[model samples]
Target: MESPPADTAPQTPALTYRAPTEEDHARVLAVLDRWWDGLGGDDGARQRAGLLPRLFFQHFTDTSVVVERDGHLVAFLIGFLSQSRPEEAYIHFVGVDPALHGHGLGGELYRRFFDTVRAHGRTIVRAITSETNTGSRAFHARMGFTEAEQSFPGYDGPGTTRVTFVRELEP
Candidate 1:
């Protein structure tokens, strides 16, 4: 394929990624709720805020940082640590505001997440995304994640059924 010329492709804007504060939970929840196509209601967000913190942020840690643009919370990535020894990291969720995508914010978030995990002496970083979420799969791949395993029995638990993608962190 001819490179389509440089002008044919659009340029993306720069973004910043930083830890989310308790104040951010409400906005983050709103973004996540909107992300899942109205699957999350007021009651659901309230309940999730309680249940999720225990599962991922009990120790005062955040999975992924918030992606902001022009002083607005456009998107964010969510992850957590493992219970195993030596301390491993797992990305519980990765998302972006559909309106704010294609600007490399997601890629930067992965790099930031990897750095945080590496700092903690974690050797591996893994996460699961649905098979239907092709965009996510591609984004992970772009961030140097390889397909370590594939589980396609169609299990039901989270947003939807999809294949799992595991990426081992660098040494």
Candidate 2:
């Protein structure tokens, strides 16, 4: 089959980023499991949904972001300045429409988060992922996060170990 002319080929839609509102709770949850399906099976995805409670949308809207393409939800980054550690920020969770993986959407979301936190006086950013998640580990590394020497056992709960990452923001 012959390829379509360059001008006739489909173009990527422009993405819009904005702060998530309380009303977006349902919308994000609706797609959370499906977006995480590749990392975990259906059952795992269902369990993962519980990890992101409604609290992020309710209280962290200022630091959180939702991304869309043509009015459809495509990605999000839920993060916040550390209440206890004034110089630190934590990225609670992030998700990108799996179909758009490798398109730089995730990196762009992270860069936005970094800029926000840096403007807030945060000197460090931290995040975590399951030890089994090689994709996340690699992605974090690519994003300039340094992994801890060892996984933290029971970091999430009994029998759950997690790989922690930290990055120092350039001044």
Model 2 is weakest, by summed lDDT over 10 consecutive residues, at 38-47
**TM-score quality measure for candidate 2:** 0.89
Per-residue lDDT for 104 in model 2?
89
Residue 170 displacement (Å), model 1: 2.3
lDDT for every model?
0.67, 0.89
Error of 2 at 159 (Å): 2.3
Model 2 lDDT tens row, 1-171:
999999999988788889999888889989876777646576467557877889999899999999999899999999999999999999989999999999888999899999999999999999998888888899999999999744999897776688999999997
Candidate No. with top lDDT: 2
- Residue 50 of model 1: what lDDT? 49
Give me the runs in candidate 1 sitting further than 4 Å from their true place: 1-16, 36-63, 85-87, 154-160
Q: Best candidate, TM-score-wise?
A: 2
Q: Model 1: what TM-score?
A: 0.70
